[model samples]
Target: MLQYQTIPVTPFQQNCSLVWCDQTRSAAVIDPGGDLPRILAEVKRLDLKLEQIWLTHAHIDHAGGTAELARQLSLPIIGPHKGDQFWIDGLAQQGKMFGFPHAEVFTPTRWLVDGDTVTIGNSTLQVRHCPGHTPGHVVFYSAEAKRAFVGDVLFAGSIGRTDFPQGDHDALIASIRERLWPMGSDTVFVPGHGPESTFGRERRSNPYVADGV
Candidate 1:
């Protein structure tokens, strides 16, 4: 079975997830934004054999600690597609702007695409390029677990801000309608900065992309 725990990091309280295969005890940390001590403590408590670092996007709040964390863990960093390279390059500037710790730019060990697959232990996750919140934003979905880790895309009741660089409101909506909806209504998703919710719940009540709203 696959298990995950959400560790809220940074002042933004972004959801950094530790997803692992229970059988193998192999794990990956998704979006280690900040609060490295807290994140590391959690990993220690879980006794998880950390393998790689996964990212959904490159926002300061979602990726601020990625470079440092990867360095400490000596783990591979992956994802967010290559389109987010600009954001990655501006990590230092983004940190200064956001009053966060000095963040360093980095290159992922592997750049993800729409159809990429990520393996953790014996579990595999499908990657969907759901650009909008950011040009290279991606969502990690596990069909076997009926769960997805979505960053700055669809929120509990509201959607991501499309005012940032390369944000596209139309593309966000289409990604939700075309790419995410097909994953099934029962799919539970963990967003970057809020509580988790099911596609069914969001589709029925989300003001931004509700099926009826």
Candidate 2:
């Protein structure tokens, strides 16, 4: 079975997941917003090799500490290409605007596309491009685990805000309904923030989904 642990990092409380295969001890770090020390500690505690760092989107809170973590672990960074390249390139500016102590932009070693698969050890995480919160937003789905790491595109009882630059309300809504909802009703959703939820639960209870449904 695949083992998963979530470390809530940075001021945004982004959920950074450390997923590993028990047999191979190979792991992927998902959305390392910050707290490099804690991430490293978990890697050590789990006795796993950090193979790659994956980003759900390029927002400051999601990609801010990627550079430092990659440098320390010497792991490749991977992310979808559709979202805010401008935001990824100008992370420092976004950090300054938000009053963060420091922020640095780190280019991904690989740009993900729809249908791409990220493999670590015995598992594969399929990339689903669900653009709405940001133009290039994506979710990582592990079919075997019946889980999806949905970035800012979704939340517990709500969806991501579309007030940011390049954010589109209609597009966001459509993406969630078309791309995410079809994943499976029982898939567990590990969002960018807040508590975990299921696609089935969100589809029925989320106001955004209710409006769309």
Total backbone collisions for each predicted model? 0, 2
lDDT agreement of model 1 with the native? 0.93
Best by TM-score: 1
| Tens-digit lDDT track of model 2 for 78-173 | 995645688788889888888765877777899888889888899888898888788888889988899999989999999998999888999989
Candidate 2 Cα deviation (angstroms), residue 83? 3.4
What residue pairs are clashing in model 2? 82-136, 83-136
Predicted structure 2, TM vs. truth = 0.95
Error of 1 at 52 (Å): 0.3
What would the TM-scores of all predictions be? 0.98, 0.95
- Of candidate 2, the 10-residue stretch with the lowest lDDT total is 204-213
Q: List the residue pairs that clash in candidate 1.
A: none
lDDT of 2: 0.86
lDDT of 1 by residue, 1-213 (tens): 779999999999999999999999999999999998998898899999999999999999999999998888798999989989999999999999989999989889999999899999999999999999999999999999999999988989988899999999999999899888899999999998889999889989998899952
